[model samples]
Target: MVLPPLRRLLRTAAWLLLFAALGALGLLLVRAFEARGKPDLMPWHRIVLAQELSADTLDARSTWADVLAREQQVFDDLHAQLAAAAVPGEFRYERGSRIGARAGERDGNRSFESMPAEPRGGVLLLHGLTDSPYSMHALATIYERAGFAVIAPRLPGHGTVPAALLDVRWQDWSAVVRIAMRELRARVGADAPIHIVGYSTGGALALDYALDALDDARLPAPQQVVLVSPMIGLRPFASLSRWLPLYGRFDYFEKSNWIDILPEFNPYKYNSFPANGALQSYLLTARLRGRIATRAAGGNLARLPPLLAFQSVLDSTVSSADVVHALFDRLPANGSELVLVDVNRASLLAPMLRSAAAGQIDVLRGTKPRAYRLDIIGNLRADTLDVGEQRYDPGSRVPVERPLRLAFPSDVYSLSHVALPFPCDDPLYGTTPRADEDYGIRLGTLVLRGERGALQVSAEQLQRLTCNPFFTYLEERVDAVLR
Candidate 1:
C-alpha cells in the first residue's frame, strides 16, 4: 500500500512539473510573437505611393494632392497607433510640409523641397531601400540647420505601398537622383555647387550618380558627397536565388540575430520588405560598386566628384569594407578624403541602438587616423567576417586598419559614413521633450536673457541639451575640419 501511494505521488509531481514547464514556454513564445508581430507604424502603402511619385510613373490622375491626402490618412492612422503606444508628441505630425517647391521651365519638372536652403550649397537626400522620404527628414533638418539646402526626394516605389517597392528597378532610383540633381541645379542656378547625400542603399545611388551619369554636360556634378551607413554588401548568409545566380535572396529571413542586437533608430522597424526587392537592391549595389571601382582605376579622375563616406563600424545590414574599397580605394590620388566614424559604446547605448543591433552593444574605437595619398592600385584588404562574429569575440575590435587609397584618377571624397546624418533624439509621441524643454525654445530664451544666458548657458550648454551620439560626432567632425 505504501509503495503504491509513493508511485502515485511521484507520477502526479512529474505531471505537474511538465505542465508548468509547458506553460512557461508558451508564455515565452507569446512574448516573442508579440515582439515580432507588432504592426508597423509606417505601412507599405505610403512608401509605394512616394516611390511612384519619385519615379514619375504614377498615372496622371494620381496627383500630388491625392498622394498628400493618402499620406495624411496614413499619418492619422499611424498617429493613433503611436499615441496608444504613448509615443512622443513633438514627433507626431498630421502633415509633413514642404519648405520650398519650384516649377522649372526646362524639363517641366516640379521640384519639392523639404529643408531650408543653406549657403554651403545644397544636399540631395535619398532614403534607403523599402523606406520613405520620412527616414531622411530628421537628417535633412540637421543639414538645414547646418546651412545646407536639403532635398530629400521620394524614391520610385517608396512613400506609397510596400508592394510597389518590389516593382522598382535600380534605374528608377538613379533616375530620381538625376532629376533631383537637375532640379537642384535649376533652383540654385547652374553654376552653384551641390552635394549628394544618401542613406543606406541611397548612398550607392549617390556614388553611381557622381561616377556614372553626372559627368554629362547636361547634369551638374556634385562638389562633395556624404554617405550615411551606405549599404555596399548584404549579409553573407542570405540565400542565392535560382533565377538570378548573383542575387542573394532574403525573403524568408525575418529578424536576423544582428538586427536584434542593435538599438532601433529607424522609424520603419515594424515594416517587412519583400525578398525580391532586397535582392534587387543587392544586385544594383554590387553592379554600381564595380563600375565606380573601374572608373576610379582608369585615371578618369575628372569624372568623379569629391566624396565623403561614413559607415557604422557596427552596422549589421551593410558591408563597410566593400563601401570603403569601392569608393575610397578606387578614387584618384589626392582627389578624395575618407573619414571613418567609429560608433563608441556610449553612443551605441542609446535607446534606438537596440533596433540596429541585437541586445548587445558593440563600440568601435580607432586610435590613429590612416591616410592614403596616390596608390590607387594597391589592393585594400578588409577582414570579410560577419560583424556579429567580430562583436562576440572578447578581444576583437572594430577594424579601421585599411587605408582608403584611390586607384583611379577621380576627385572622389568619402567621409565616415554615419556622420552625414547628424543624430537627434527620436521620441515617439508623448515622450519627447516638453514645449518648455524644446532646444530651440531654450536657445531663444537664452539669447533674450543676455548676461544671465552667458553666465548660465553657453553654446556648449545648448549642444549638451541635445545630448545625442550623432550630434556629438558632428561636433567633433566640424571641430576637426575647422581646426
Candidate 2:
C-alpha cells in the first residue's frame, strides 16, 4: 500500500543502519589487534596469574604480625614478577621510577601500618576495591587522635600490582576481614566496644559481616557501623559483568577487556582496574541484599547496630538511591542515620546536574515517620554558597536546619565516591596536609597549567576532586560517635 518513493527511502535507511553496525564491530576488531601488539601494554601485565598471593589463602591468619609478614612476602613476589616482566622505561610496571617508591624503600603503602597506643576502644577501617591501607590512613589518624586503636588492613589483592586483583574473589576479601576482626578483638578484649568503618566495596563486606554476626554468635559484632559511599547496590549492567571474560576467548580479541586498560600511575590506588574486580563486587552486593531480606523476614533485624552512612548525591560508582531504600530504610529504628552530600548549587556547573542529583534530598520522608534520621550537608540557600546541615529527626516529617562553618569550593561541583575518606590537607590526596609525612608523591597539590593531553594521566582523572572541603565536619561527626 506504500508509495514507491517512501518504500525506496525506507530501504536505503535500513541499509545505512546495517552498515553503521558493521563499521562499529570492525573498529572493535581492529582495536583488539592494536592492543595485543603494543609492547608497553601487554595481556600478562593486565592478566591475573595464579601463584597464590597471600590474599588467596586462609593460612595467613596466624596473628596480626604473621599476617603482615605474609603480606610483605607476597609483595616481594609481585615486585620481582613486575621487574622481570616490565619493558625498559615503562612507568606502569617499573617499581622505583615515576609510578612507585623513590627512596629505594619498599612502598610503605603496600604494607599494613597501625596507629596503635593506649586505646579506649578498637576501630577497624576497611578500604575500597583496588585500594590499600593508605586510603584509610587519614581516617585512622582521626581515630588514633580520638583514643581509638585503629587497625587498617591492606586487603588481599590490593597494595600491590594491578594483576593481583585478577585472581582474587570476594571470599578472599571477606576472609581477611574476619582475620582482622579477630586480631582487633584479641588486642582490645571482648568487653570493650568495637566499631567498623568501611568505604565503597568494604562497605558491602561490613554489612555482610554484620548480617552474618546477627545469625551466628561466633563472629564478632560491631557496636556501630560507619559507611562512606557504601556499595549496597550497583548498576544493573554489573550483574552481567561475568560474561566479559568470554570476549578474551577469541584469538583476535584475546586482549579485549570490559574496560580499556590504562597505565598505573597513582601510588596508593591502582590506576588499572580489571573486569573480574567489578564482577566480584557485583556478586558480593547481590549476596548482601539477599541476606538482608532473609534476616528481615525472621524479625532479627533489631540486632543490627546503628549505621552512619555518608553518600554523595552525584555518585558515578554506587547507587545513591539504594543507600536510602535497600540499606537504611530496612533498619529497625536503632538510631541509624544517612548523611547525603549535595551537589554545589552555587557553582556554574549547577545547571548541568542530572535530574537525580537535583532532587537528591527527596528520598521519601514526606508525611511519614521513618525509623532513621536523614541529614543532608548542603547549601544554606539556593542563592548562597554557604553550606549547612538539614537534619530530619526520626519520626518527624519536618527538617531542622543548622548552618555550619563550611562552604562549597567554588570550582568543585560535588564530592566524589573516593573523596569522602580524604581531607583537604591529606598528604597524598589533600591540597594541603595537616602534617608532612610523605609517601613520595603529593598528588593533592597538583595544578598543571598547560596544553590539553600534556599529562600522562587522563584529564578526567585530574578534573575529579581528590579531597573533601567538609572533612572537618566529617571528623567532628565521627569523633562525636566515638565519644
Candidate 3:
C-alpha cells in the first residue's frame, strides 16, 4: 500500500515539471516573435547611443530655457542624420512642426508665454505623455485669448524626440510641473485665481501635485482643475510593462523595450511608444490613487479644487471605470464633474459592443446625492445617430436629457482618447480641416482604401476616429465655467 501511494505522488510531480517547462518555452517563443528585426532608431536614440544614457535625462536642466536648448540640440542632430532620408509626409527633424526645435522659426514645442500686464487669471496646461505642447495648443489658445496669462511647459522627455522617453521617470515629470506652476504664479500674483489643465498623463501629474499641496505647504495650489482623458487609472498591462524592460536587458530581446516602434509620421505626437512610458504612467497613477485615498481617509479631501474631466467611454489607454470609481468617488462634494463621450450607435460595430458599455452611464453615476456631476453625450434613440447630452445633476434624483444638434458621421464610430482635445477643424487631426496652416500632410483627412496588411499602419489605427464632432459644445461648456 505504501509503495502504491508513493508512485502516485512521483507521477504528479513529474507532470507538474513538464507543464512548467512548456510554459517557459511558450513565453520565450512569444518574446522572440514580438520584435523580429533590429528596429529603426529614432533621432534621440542615435544621439543618446553615442554617450551615456544619463546624458538624455532631464534632471540636469536648471531652467526652462536650458530645457529648450537641449531639445534643440537633439533636433539639430536628428536633422543632420535623417533630413535626406525623410519623405514629405513623414516627420523629419528639419521639416516637422516640432514643438521647440525651430531655432529660427516659430517653435511650437518651446515653452509658450502670453502674459498681459494686468491678467484676469492664469492657466498652466500640461500635455500628455509622449506629446508636445502642440497637443495643448487649441486649449492654450482659448485660455490665452480669454485674458488669462497662459504658460505651457514642454515636459522634458517630450517636445524633443521619441528616444528621449527611454531614460526618464515619473518623478522627473512631476518636478517640471512644479517649476512651471511657480513661474505662472510669479507672473500672476496671489489675488489671481489659477487653473491647471492636464491632458492624458499630464492629468495624473496634476492630481498628484494637488494632493502633494495638501500636506506640503511649498506647492502652489490651483483654484480649479481640468483634465482631458486623464490617466487616472491604466490598463492591467502596465503592471507587466515594467517586466518588458527587464526582458529587454538580454541581447536577444532589446526590441521589447518599445510597445510600438513605428514610423514618425504625426508631427505633434510621437508615433512610437516605449515601455518606459507605460511603466511611469503606472507609477504615477498608483501614487495618485494612494494619495487620494489617504486624503479621503484623513478628512483632508476638502482641500481639493473643483475638477472638470472629459473622457471617452471607450478609451484604449485608460480605464473609464476608474475615473468614476477611483477619482470622482473619493471627492468631498467640491463641485467636481465628469463628462463622458459615448460611442456612435450607428456603426455596425455598435451591435458587437459589449452591453456593459452603455450601462456605464448608470454605473458611473450610482445613486444621486452624489457630489459630482455626470454628463453622458450619446444617441438617446439607439437606432438614430443624432447626438444628445444626458445630464445627471448633482444631488438630484432624475437625469435631464437634451439634443445637441450634433451627429456622428456615418463612418465614425467612436472618439478615441487622443481625439477629445482636437476639434473637427484642427489642421493636423481634423476631419474637416480649416487649413489655416499646412503641416505638409493631412493626417486627419486621410481616407485610404486598400487590402488589409498592405498598409504600414494597422487598419484599426486608421479606422479610429481622430477628431471630435461636438468640439464646439465642449468649448462652450468650458467657456461657460470660466466666464
Candidate 4:
C-alpha cells in the first residue's frame, strides 16, 4: 500500500535533518584533526588547578575573608605545580616573574577589597569570563576614590590556569556572586546603597543577580546596575561548542578540548580558551533569556533597579542587537539607560568599512520607541573628528545633541568589546601606557607591519582596538552616578 502524502513528507524531512546533522558532525571531526597541529600543551593548559572552588564546595554564606583564604590556597597550589614542572621563565605561571600571575602586593589575579576611612556605600566589581579581577582594578580604584567601598572577586576557574576553565560551571560563578554580595552588604550595612559594575560575562551575572533579587527578598538588591560590553547573547554556533570537545572519547583527540590554545602571555587574562568555557557561557545566557522573559511577562522587572549599560556598536564576540532587544527592551522605564559607542565615522578608513558596520548605529536606533534613554557617542559631523553625544530620551525619536570634548584618534576606527573598561593610559592595554605603571607588555600600543600569516598572533588580534580612547568620558559618567 502507498503511504499518504503527509506521512511521506514527514519521512523526507526527517531524513534531510539526519543528513544535515551528519554533515555538521563530519566537519567538526575534520576541524578536530586540524587542531592537532597547534602548539604543544603546556603545564598551565594540562594541569587543572586543584584548589579552585568546585561547585559542590562553594557556599553562599561564605564571607569575603573566607574567599580570600581559599584564593591564597589556590595560588600556593598553582605555584607548587608550576615549580615542579619548571615552566619557562617567559610563561605567566613562572613564579617570581614580573609578568607572572602573583607578582606584587596588589596582584590583579587575586580577589581584593578597598575601603575609605569611612565608606559612604559599597560596590561590587565583576570581571568577564577568562579575565581576572585585574580587569576591574582600575574601575574599582575609581569607585573607591569616589568614597565607595569596593570588592572585586576572582570568579571560579579564572586567574589560575586555562585548565581550570575546563571544569567550571556557570552556577559556581553565580554562587561566588552571592557570597561577595553578602560580604559587601555586611560591610556597608543595610541602610547604605549597594551597586554593581559588571563587565562582559560579569554583566550577565549582574543582571542575573538583580533578577533573582526580585523574587527573593533574602538577597540584597543593588541600588543601581552598570554594565560594560555585557554578554547578552553570543553567536548561534556557540551552542554547538558543547559537543566539539570530545577528548574523553579518544586519547588521540586531546587537543580537541581547547578552542584556541595560545601562549599565556597576558598577565591577568587567560590566552587559551577551552570549549567548556564557551559552553558554560552559552548555558548562562540561555538561563538568563528565560529569566528575563519570565520576569518581563510577570511584570516583575519594574521592581528591578535602574540599569546603565555601555555597548560598542561593532562587537564580534557578543550580539549588540540582543543587548537592546533582549535585556534593555524588557527593562521597565525606571531610568534605565544605554550608551552606545558608534564607529569613528570621520576616520580616513571610513571608505574601507563594510556598509553594515557604517550603518550599525542607525540599525540599533530602530523605529520602535524604547523605554530607556539611548545615547550614541559619535562624530559631531561627517567631516570632523570631534565627537558628540546624541541623547534620545524614552519614547522619543528626536535627540538633543551635545558636543563633547573628546575626539576620536585618527588611527582608530572603532571601539571593541574588551576596550570599554580600559583607559587609554592603562598599563597593559593602553594607547598611552602610564610611565609609572607597567605590566611588562603594552598590547594596546603595539604597531607591527608584516606580510599576513607571518606571526603567531593573527593580524585581526593585533588590529583590534584594545583600549578605549574615550575612557576618560566613561570614567566621568560612572563617577557622576556613584557620587
Candidate 5:
C-alpha cells in the first residue's frame, strides 16, 4: 500500500513540472509576438497617413534624395493634393507685394507706405524662430481691416538666408523688436497704446520684452500683448538630451536628423544653423523667466504689462502649458490672465478626457498653483489632434491613417504662422471669397460659449483683441459687461 501511494505522488509532481514549463514557454511566445508586432522597422511611407504626405512632402523628397528621384516625384504629387484641399483663396498673393527684399536696397524707405493703415491701434507682428515676417501677412491684413496699422518686421538673419540664422543670437532678434517698437512709437506716438503680437518664439520674445524692457525709458510698454503658441520651454524630445552626454556635447548633432524629420512644415531646413542656436533660445527663455522671478520677489511688479496668451493644447511643436505657467508665476498678483484654447474639441478626440484610460490621450495640466478657467473650442476641421502614437503601426506594411487636425490655434484663426504680415483678404492668393467664411468665426464663438449656454469672453481675449484682431465674441462680452 505504501509503494502505490508514493508512485502516485511522483506522477503528480512530474505533471506539475510540465505545466510550469509550458507556462514559461507561452510567456516567451507572447513577448516575442509583441515585439514582432511593434511599430519599429515599418517603412516611413507606411507610418504616416496619406494626408501627412503633403505636410511631409518637402522633408520626404529632400531627405530621400539619396534613395531616388522617384521619391521626390511622389511627394510632389502629395504636395499638389494638399494645396487643393487647403482653404480656397487662402494662399493667394497680392500684386506688387514683395516677399523678400534684397540687401542694400535704396528704395526700402520708399516702400514703407505700401502697407495700408487701419482704424485700430498699430500692430507690431513678430515671427517665431527659424521663420520670417512673411508668415504674418494674412493675419496682418485682418488687423488692417479691423482698423489697425500693422508692422510685420523680419527678425535678424531671417528672410535673407538660412545661414544668417546660425550666427544670430537671441539678443539680435530682441534688438530688431526694439527697433520696430521705436518705429511704431514714432509712427503712432508714445502713448498711442501699441499692441504687440508674436507667434512661437516670437511670442516668447514679445513676453521677454514685456518683462524686461517694456517700461524702459527708451521705449514705452506695449498697450497690450498677444502671444500665440509661445515656446517657453524645451519640448518633450529635448528631455532625452539631458540623459545623453553626447547630445549635450554636440550642439549640431541633432540638427541633421531634425532637419530631415519634418521638411515641408519647416522649409528652412537647408538654412539650419548650429545646434547652439537652439541652446541660445533655451537659455534666453530661462533667463527671461529668472529675471521675471527676481523682479517679482523684489516686489517690482509695476514694470510688467497686462498680457494675454493664446495656446493650442494639441500643438505638437511647443509646450503650451510651460509658457502659461512661466508667465503666471512671474506676473504680479492679478496682473495677467491665462487662456487655454482647445483646438481639437470636435474630432474623435473631442471628448479627450474620456479616453484617458486607453493611454492615448491626456489633458494640459497647469503646473502653477493657480487654477485657470479652461475654454475648449472645436476647430473647423475634424477637431482631433493626431498624437501620432495611435495611428503609428510599426508592424503594418501599408500606410497608416492620416492625422487631421489644425497645426495651430492661429491656423483656425485664418492665419498661418508665415502669413500674419498681410491683410486677411489680401489679394495675394486672389480676391475670391473663401468657401468657409465661418472658419475662425466658429472657433471664436466656441471660445466664448460657456457652460449653461452663457457667453463671456475671457479677460485674455479682451487684451489680445484690444488693438489687433477683433473677435465678435469679445465684442459681445464687452457689451454685456458694460450693460
Candidate 6:
C-alpha cells in the first residue's frame, strides 16, 4: 500500500508526461505543415524505378551480373521517368542538364569495374548511404594505377532516389556486400589478396562483414579493412526516429517522412535525407556494437583481420569516441592502426572550439593500454601551422614525433567527415578542381556571401570543407598497406 501523498505526486507526474507527449506531437505536425510550402516533390522522390530485387534475391547465390542488370534497369527507368514527368529545372533530376546524373559518366551512378592487365590483387570499394559509385571513383583510379582490379558497387537503394531508402533494410546492404565480395574473390582467384575500403556507412558494412567472416568459413576475409569516417555509432535521437514515421504513413502527413527536403542539387549524392535512412543506420550500428561486444567476450576477435581507419577528431556525422571505445579498444594485438586527423591547433579559430572539442585529443591519448597503434596528424606546435605525425605504438603512451613536409592551410580549422576521401585536385569537391575534368558543378569552389534567407540549404552546409588538404598523406599510407 502506498501513502496518500505519494499517490497524489505519482498522479501529477503521469499527467505531466502525457502533456509533454502531446506537446511533442503538436510540434512535429507543425513542422510537417511548414514543409508543405518548401519545394514540390520531384519525380525522383516519388518513383521507385528498380523494384525487382528483394533482400531474398540478394544472397550468396546472386551474381554481379544480376546486380548490374538490375542497376541498368534502374537507370533506364530513371532516365525515362525523369524525361517524361520531370520538368526542366536547375535540379539534378532534369534530363540532359549539366548538373544531371546523365551529364556525367555514362555509368557513373552504377556499379563499375576497373581492371588492370595481369592484376596483382582485387579491391572492393563500398560507398556511403545516399552516395553513388562516384564517391569511390577517385579511389578506384588510385588502386587501378597500382595494378589492382577494383570493383565499386552501388549499394541497393542508393545512387537512385531518396524514396528508395524508405523500403531498404540493412540486411539487403549486407547481402550486397557479400555478393560483391564473392565477385572480387572470383576475379582475383583464391591465392591473391582482396581488400575492402569503406567510407561512412560503408565502413560499418565492411567491419560487419569482417566480423561475420570470423565465424563463417564460406566468407572471404579481407587482408586489410580500410575505413574513412566509419559509422560505428549514432546519436540516441536516431533510434527515436522509428516512431516519428508512424504519422508519416498517412498521406496527409507524408512530408513528415523526410528529415530534410532540400533540392537534389548534387548528381551523385542525395541532398534530401529521409527518416527511414536515419532509422536504418541506427539499427545497423546498434546491432554492430552488440556483435562487437559478443565477439570480444568470446575471444573470437583474435582472428579478425587488421583494420586501418582514418577519422577526423571532430566529426559532425559519426561519433569519434565510439570508434575508439567500441571498436579499437576491443581489438587484439593485431597490427591494426587508427589515424586521427586532429584539428588545426595553430588556427585562429582554435580558441573558439568547445571545451569538449578542445579536450578530445587528450581524451583519445589517455593512459589506458590500447591494443592497436594510434597516429595523430596535427600541428607540431601552437605557434606554427606546420604539421607532424605523432605515433603511439600498442600499449605505449610515449609518442615518437616525425615531422612531415605538410602544413595545415591557414584558413582550415579542421578536416570534416566528408573531406578525408578525396584529394585536393578532385574534380567535384576539390579546393582546386582539376582543369582537365568537369563534373558540371564544382561544389568546393563556391564562396557565397549573401543574406541568411537567400538559399534553401543552410549557409553552414555550403561553407563546410568538402575535400582533404592532407589527401596525399592518406594516399601514401593506403598505398604502403597495399605494398
Best by TM-score: 4
Question: lDDT at 77 for candidate 2?
Answer: 70
Best by lDDT: 4
Lowest summed lDDT across 10 adjacent residues in model 1 is found at: 384-393
Write candidate 6's Cα lDDT for 1-483 as tens digits. Answer: 999999999999999999999998888778677656657666777777665455787766789888888878877887677778867766677754677443344556788897777888999998998888887877787788789989998888888788888778888888888888998988888988999999999999999999888878899889889999999987778887776666777777787787788888787899988888898899999999999999888887988889999999888889998998899999999999999998998999999988898889888777897899999999999889999999999999899999989999998999998888988888888889997777578888889887898999999898889898988888888888889
Put the candidates in TM-score order, highest first: 4, 6, 3, 2, 1, 5
Across 99-146, the per-residue lDDT of candidate 2 in tens digits comes to 545566546466444545666778888899888777887778777887
In angstroms, how far off is 257's CA in candidate 6? 0.5
**Winner on lDDT (1 vs 4):** 4
Residue 396 error for model 5, in Å?
49
Over all chains combined, what TM-score does candidate 4 have? 0.95
**For model 2, what is the C-alpha lDDT against the true structure?**
0.77
**Which has the better TM-score: candidate 1, or candidate 3?**
3
Instruction: Report every candidate's CA lDDT.
Output: 0.47, 0.77, 0.77, 0.87, 0.45, 0.85
Better TM-score candidate (4, 6): 4
Candidate 1 ranges with C-alpha deviation above 4 Å: 1-51, 54-120, 237-270, 343-424, 428-470, 475-483
Compute the lDDT for candidate 1: 0.47
Q: 1-483 in candidate 4: lDDT tens per residue?
A: 657998899999999999999998888888789878878888888886777875578766677687788889998998788889875566577655567433354778888888777889999999999999989977887788878989998999998899999889999889889989998898888899999989999999999998888879989899999999998899897898898886435768888888888877788899899999999999999899888988888888888899989999999988998898889888889999999999998999998999999999988999888899999999999899999999999999899999999999999899998999988888888888887777777788888887888877777987788888888878887887886
How many steric clashes between backbone atoms does each model show?
68, 2, 2, 0, 26, 0
Colliding residue pairs in candidate 3: 99-109, 100-109
Error of 1 at 127 (Å): 1.4
> On residues 1-483, what C-alpha lDDT tens digit does candidate 1 reach at each position?
569889999999999999997886666445444434433333222333331433455332444344445435544554464344453332111123111111231110122364354355677888777666655655566556666666776665554334455456877677667766766666666665687878888887887787755467766788776666777776663333212211212322222111112211223321344545666677877788677656656777555665555554445567766666555655654435444433332322333444444221222222222332211111132221111111111122333333332221111111223324534343311113234222212211222233444432234322222212334443344333222
